[model samples]
Target: MAVRSWVNAFAVIILSVGQASAESSSGSLASSVKRLTDKFMATGAEGTPPGIPAISVAIGRDGKLLYADGFGQASENRPATAGTIYMVGSITKQFAAAAILRLIEKGATLRHGSTLLKTTTPVSSLLDIANDWTLEGGPPITVAHLLSMTSNLPNFTRRPPHELDPWGAVPAKQLLGGMKEYRPSGYPGSFEYSNTSYFLLSEIMENVEVGGSSRDYHRILREELFTPLGLSDTGFGGDSWEANRLANPHYRRRPRFSQPDWLKGSGDVASSVIDIFKWNKALMEGQALSPQMRDLMLSDCARVDVWTYYGMGWFISHKDGTDRFFHSGTVSGYTSYNLIVRPSPAHWVSVSLLANSDGVEGVDSLADELAELALKS
Candidate 1:
């Protein structure tokens, strides 16, 4: 589960996990809702992935956190809790997207030098792209194309002769530079998920030598998005993660997911359920970007499949009558999910799930179950 940056689902939070429900704030969840969670999420998962032993969930409605809880164990003795931190992999993309928009909104032109960076601007204009890459017929990839996942750039992750070793933690610049060698694998207009597209976007952002805008991605995120939004608990792995109760990677080797360098703007951020809920509320309520840019970011920029559309950092899809805007993340020893559902413009609900193990699909399925019940209740 790299990400659904889609994460595979896992079991519900009803288990032998330390704090399980002892410290959970479940008053807002109706008895019926709890029964529904107990019925579906009730049992099915035996905590298969030995590495993935804990799952935490937080729910928000109308603009407030309605419920927050954890299931399973953080370690042999430690219990996963609402405040438990997990490396939210590609969920980091959302913060990266917000940083880009916020920088643009702060009167800083989205350009590094001669190029006037706008949504319509081509990738060739921003970075020193390879000459061989081509659409073969149509227009070249643009800022909007990259943001919406229409840039058919090759994904180095799935390759026969890997450009950068998928397991090696390279820097963002190295990843982007490696992408220069690969020609366009598909047309520039179709939906294709590529981390290189975002690496390029981050480079473009970093190169924006404006009045005082830092060239660093992490610094930009901390200054522009996290600090301004009051998200103190959300930060990069190696930096701010250890200060809190962290869900360590659960593999036999038990290596940490600390190397986010190559994954910089792509899938390298850590956070908690409570902090995630606050982020979703602030983002959807227009506190993140101006209404115009926010709408564009959430707009159906490109279709992912039959139902899902790729927006800037989120996926937009529909179930029954409700519209959902969300993203998920997966890293070693971790899996994460974020969701916002609109039953109507006036009604809203959000859910954030983080698990310590991988290979479990229940995490994704559990999110669907919880979101549906929350919307109805």
Candidate 2:
């Protein structure tokens, strides 16, 4: 299967499993979750190859944190805790998307009658290379297309020598500067998942003047999203002091290199599982965005396949006729998953999982199992 299809299928497998078990009351919710967590940690025992250095899990229901804990070790000696930070990978896209929407909302109220961004706005207006990056006379790409992963931009990281060092820094300008050499794989509205789409969006955020002069996308995220939501433990993983508290990324039971500076808006954010749950609470409570903006962020914009739809930075799915918003991320040595089910018809719940090793056995399945237990509780 294609890589994108495999990702979608894996997600479906977990969500399907979770929903199937949601109605079955096997034991107390806490006990069930603990059992699942135990199963997850067992896979990372001493004998396991590339054992997880740390794993953190958090669950929320109806805007309240239900449980938050960590398993395994953060390092050789330090034990992991709920507050142990980890690179959340593509889950950072949601914060990036929120920053853009916040800018648009702010622009709408400007005294000079500013041109607020809409879904149809041409991406070229914000990113310089979009003007020339086309394939076979395809239509101009739009902001919505990027959000929906339908911009058709080439997946640069997947190019020759597929295993590029994730810790090395690559400037966004340098990345975009090289885009002229590649052509779009599909038309503007075609769904093709690409990290380049989000990296371009990050560049656009940096270029657009919002709340005065332009700032780094990471700053915009902190001011517009993190600060308001009180996500103190969430930010770009750059500070040495904060780094001391972070769970070490590992491969084959050894420490891996650090994250790249260029992963800023796409995946570089380090955050605790508890902070992620807090983010879910703020988002679902309408504290982070206006109702209309929230709807836009959650609304399905493109069909990813038969079972999934892509929104701004979220993957929209349905379980037993209930809407679910989720995204998973896998960088060099970390894997993260975040899921939020809004209230009404659905049993409102949020689950966030962060592990120090990418592709750790049964991590995703454990997340789903924990979600199921949380929802049923």
Candidate 3:
């Protein structure tokens, strides 16, 4: 996890030369981005893990990739690069949410030909648990409730010690079957972060249709979001060439293993810093979603606390009079953070960070700091 801060002057010079037009267009903000990202990765400090085994960062301003760089080893032998893929946990939810919105835009109704749109469909129509379980007179959950993490679904991670392997391969059916033991605590409209809600959403998307026949969630995402946005490196993890390029996952300096297939839409997408930047830019440019859908995705639907709100797949916050949309993911052996700051109509800045080791101090802080720096620049 030790990282040597040897600046790649040659690479910088080449990138600067190649991006002269972009620099001119951004009016010196590009230079500021480059300077800030050059120091983005942290050298391990006391109480923190030695250093990030592999860290990749990308900064975008006004829908342009201003700076991107990688540090440390992607694997045992491979040096980190802009294309080194890492499992980006809950950030995958954004793509899933986008796919749902795409289906809605295509005029897809809920299962059973219900007139309800994607957001209004009741959870009972999609999954068996909603019918079998009761919430002590609470209202039935809806698609909007799940999307906003207000479904009051029981968090599987809170299961007894025997079920604490958050990254282990648990079948989706098995996970759902066990939910009968617990009852919903919070009301349907109250905020409760639940991966199960998204997992069920994934299931619903697979069985329902937009235009004609039903499609798998992964296929829907690929066609509607990744392919259109040119996110070539992002996909489900498995024994594939893309998987081979994954920066090895680690926890406390020990190598961690890969996740199973059942995570699906909740947290099972992998991508590099550059592709993530592309996603943020596509979002900003209205390429991935219509203007109304984009507003819906970014709108604050449920309050997480006094200062934070949960939108469709994003956490919305405001700092110093600027609006921020962000999400962080933590699975076994990996942690990631993505931040987008919209300070003005003409300015948008995004920062994406992927790290191999779990519980790494400063990963989130570094992303926030870089976003702030990009905004100021």
Best by lDDT: 3
Runs of candidate 1 exceeding 4 Å displacement: 1-51, 107-112, 130-133, 160-163, 240-244, 252-260
- Among these predicted structures, which one has the highest TM-score? 3
| Cα-based TM-score, every candidate | 0.83, 0.84, 0.85
* Superposed Cα deviation of residue 217, candidate 3 (Å): 1.7
Candidate 2 achieves a global lDDT of: 0.72
Clashing pairs in 3: none
Candidate 3 lDDT over residue span 1-377, tens digit each: 11122223423553587542334444565465445444544444344344567788777778766667777788887887767788898898998898888887888765567554568777777667677433447566778888998877676555522443545666656665666465667664689888877877887787677655677777888888888787777887662643346888887644322446456778888888878888998888899999899899999999999999999999998767789899998766778889998887678889999888776666666777777666655
Q: Compared with the true structure, what per-residue lDDT tens digits does model 2 show for residues 99-188?
A: 878878877222233545666677766666677654357667777777788877777656512334434655556666766566666555
Which ten-residue region of model 3 has the weakest summed lDDT? Answer: 1-10
Q: lDDT for model 1, on a 0 to 1 scale? A: 0.69
lDDT for model 3, on a 0 to 1 scale?
A: 0.74
Error of 1 at 25 (Å): 18
lDDT of 3 at 100: 83
lDDT digits (tens) for residues 62-99 of candidate 1 = 77565676667777777777777788877887887777
What candidate 3 gets wrong by more than 4 Å, as runs, is: 1-14, 17-47, 110-116, 132-136, 160-168, 242-244, 253-258
Give the better candidate number (1 or 3) by lDDT: 3
Ten-residue region with minimum lDDT total, candidate 2? 1-10
